[model samples]
Target: MFGVEARALMLEGVNELADAVQVTMGPKGRNVVIELSYGTPKITKDGVTVARSMAFENRVKNVGAALVKQVANATNAVAGDGTTLATVLARSIFAEGTKSVAAGMNAMDLRRGMNMAVDTVVEYLKSKAKTISTPTEYAQVASISANGDAEVGDLVAKALEKVGKEGVITISEGKTLENELEVIDGLKLDRGYLLTNFITNTRTQKCELDDPLILVHEKKISEASKLKPLLQLVVKLQRPLFIVADDVVGEALTALVVNKVRAGLKVCVIKAPGFGSYRIDHLLDFVALTGSKLISESTSLKLEDVTVEMLGNAKKIIVTKDDTIILGAVGDKQVIQERRDEVTSQLKKATAKFDKEKLEQRLSRLSGGVAVIKVGGASDVEISEKKDRVVDALNSARAAAYEGIVPGGGVALLQASRELDKIKTTNFEEKVGVQIIQIAMKIPAYIIAANAGYEASMVVGKLLEKIENDSFGFDAAQGEYVDMFKAGIVDPVKVLRRAIQDAVSVSTLLTTTEAVVYPNYTSNSNSNLHYN
Candidate 1:
């Protein structure tokens, strides 16, 4: 399809998806009940989840829906809490852009204008953002993201208080009916076991080792011969062996797998974290944490000559497909503290922003512990939904901590739209494009008010009249206008910034698209048409 007809079909798709997703937008947004392929139906208020579950029978419409889904997914991946807002923005942009294009406006010029407007709004948001650091501020942001759930908000704040901003916080199902938070004296790595065959627990799909002897190798172990002596010693001692190396491949990996399958040898191998010199620094940190010596070419130590005393010991280690957690690492406190001080010194001297960030992360991992939030509910469906909220809350809190926050309830974007009028455009079409975005920016605040049973136009009009106070807006929950920040209503600046940028990126591409293609599957045909 080409021209107006194609764009019209795509707009139908955009509207269909936006309509379903926008309902779950604000504090009072309604939950969407999605039927699953198996088991009970899933109920959620998560915008990304709702967007992902949507599908249209019409292929062209599905393409439109998929494009909106991309915006939601990208927002979720980058900023975590603004997926719904991103969808709302995308729908509005494409809807308005489609009409402009149908009326003979240049799509490219319009896109350029939209981009310019988005850039201005993003800068405006950054300028108006207030940095938040206290636990109370963290809870406020979390609560709003969790759809006004105070308990989830408190839990997230407490987790961040315990784990620090850079530390890892993981969400899982609770064993009991009450939500619980656990702070572990452990370290988490992004790297996991190299192969699933090393897994010992089928239920969790993890490789679990108890009182494991950790081997920290700086170089690859390609030959099984170099590992023979260490393997023999571990087997004789009847202890599980956990290997962290640059890479474990070829004959060495094969031998380990064969021994694990046939001889019931408890062993697992994972590639060390980071790369190049960074990898060496991470290995040194790991070694210091575990009281293990590094088997490196820099040292006189060789793999075959390594003794049991040189190996690190841990109370327990859990290895999953994407990450690993080391619990109760057995290392000397003084040595760990020394390593911590060294990293601190290096961090203070670091000049580059990237180097400083990496150093900060290492310092956090060294001193800051890991936190686990166990979400609880009466049923599997309830637990799943609550877990999603918890995750969103956590992510929002982290983002707020990093880049500060702005007025919530869409007041930030609503006020930012006013700045678009000041943006000078080169042509009438470009000016129209800027006008389109200016109107689109108001939609979030409008839908948020409309969803709460208030007259959206009245709320938006009143807010615009009071635009001098950037933080002033309608508090739909209370049915009154108030300062959003004073009312504890806030959103991470990063979330809002990313949402606008991503929405414009995908929506403008969609607005300018003159063609779409899909497989024509007949009723009796076995051909599978998949749209990703």
Candidate 2:
């Protein structure tokens, strides 16, 4: 039967994981080189990746490691940052719980107390949050999370400013000119390439049509005779033609592809999106967007009915395997404006969450300008690290815009802990919980100070005393407490809250574990142990 030995095993494994991960918790944190099973070594400072690389032969140890990994992964997923903080917090909480349990404290009591503390701390954090307003503040938040890289932060801030709040930002790893970024007046379509053969540009694996004539038809075209007139007209214009149709089959589809292959005609066709009324609405939307008339069941479903007057124009159309994006749609300004107004009205009335999100996306497409950041590094390792940093910087910047920023460098957490001291708890569970959280809150700053080779207790104690109401705390790097925001040390409120929520969840769950079941012991293999 499982007893003290099992609990010890669990706690020991968890402690090891936490200690290794915590070493990489701060700005001055060290990197870890992990040797893969294939004998390739990779170095990184990312807590989630480091935690994931660790493996244990003992089941109980593995279980403990798994719990820590879950917290790291979940924290990163919610906030796109703060993996290291979450790992360190979870480890600290677990260590405290183990100590209390050893001193005859009930596991359930500890769990309840921690839960109450988490809620209280989170609420307090929200109250202390200051919404980021200036571009300098935005850059500060981005830079802190991007390993103090000011260039990355500046890039993200400028790019976001160009794209607006609702505009999309896409990141790709590639080589380009230094500090190069592009903003395109484009729309991200939901429809992709209809056929691989239709992809005109093999180099980019995209079907790029320049100033292509757009035709939106709802009916299938199965006969070459039906398209003969439209083909003749397109040939006469000597411009590429893009057909968005319900279906193009039989000789009509074959003839179009054959002619394009033989340089007889320039044409690419894709299936129109949606069905029934939805299909009709999308067609109508494009009608205003591209100034294209619909040749549907109502318009006499025949290519003979297709005329130059019905054709719309797009400055550039790129059809990829996943979707089609159009730029500079040339349509009647009045028609497009009217359609935009209608969508805006619909968006206001959209109640369901999904409907609201979809409407918002539609509105974004109507109002263009999407920014793409092409990030590059000299090596594979550098590129991978840069990509992660860029993403964290972007997300942190957006989070700052969406909510606000708070004092960083453990100052906020220390301040949040002080908040719990103001509340008087009658229940013993809540009181104990508050006490635990108060200690847990100091862990981050303490670890940060320790990582810098300074006395943790002295740094944290001074911070706890100095940061009473205002946002001020010890800067581990400077060895003194100062106003965090003024020092350009800030974090997203969302990221901090998310990290605490996930850390408490994992820590509380791990605290109540009474047993470590090693099932099917005989079948177990690969008994070698590993650590990071």
Clashing pairs in 1: none
Worst 10 residues of 2 by lDDT: 523-532
lDDT of 1 by residue, 483-511 (tens): 88988889999999989899999999998
Question: Across residues 224-315, which tens digit of lDDT does each residue of candidate 2 receive?
Answer: 99888888888889988899888899999888888888865667777887666567667777778898888866866456877788899989
Candidate 1 weakest lDDT stretch, 10 residues: 523-532
- lDDT for each candidate structure: 0.90, 0.79
Candidate 1 clashes: the total is: 0
**TM-scores for every predicted model:** 0.77, 0.80
Best TM-score among the predictions, by candidate number:
2
Best by lDDT: 1
RMSD of 1: 7.1
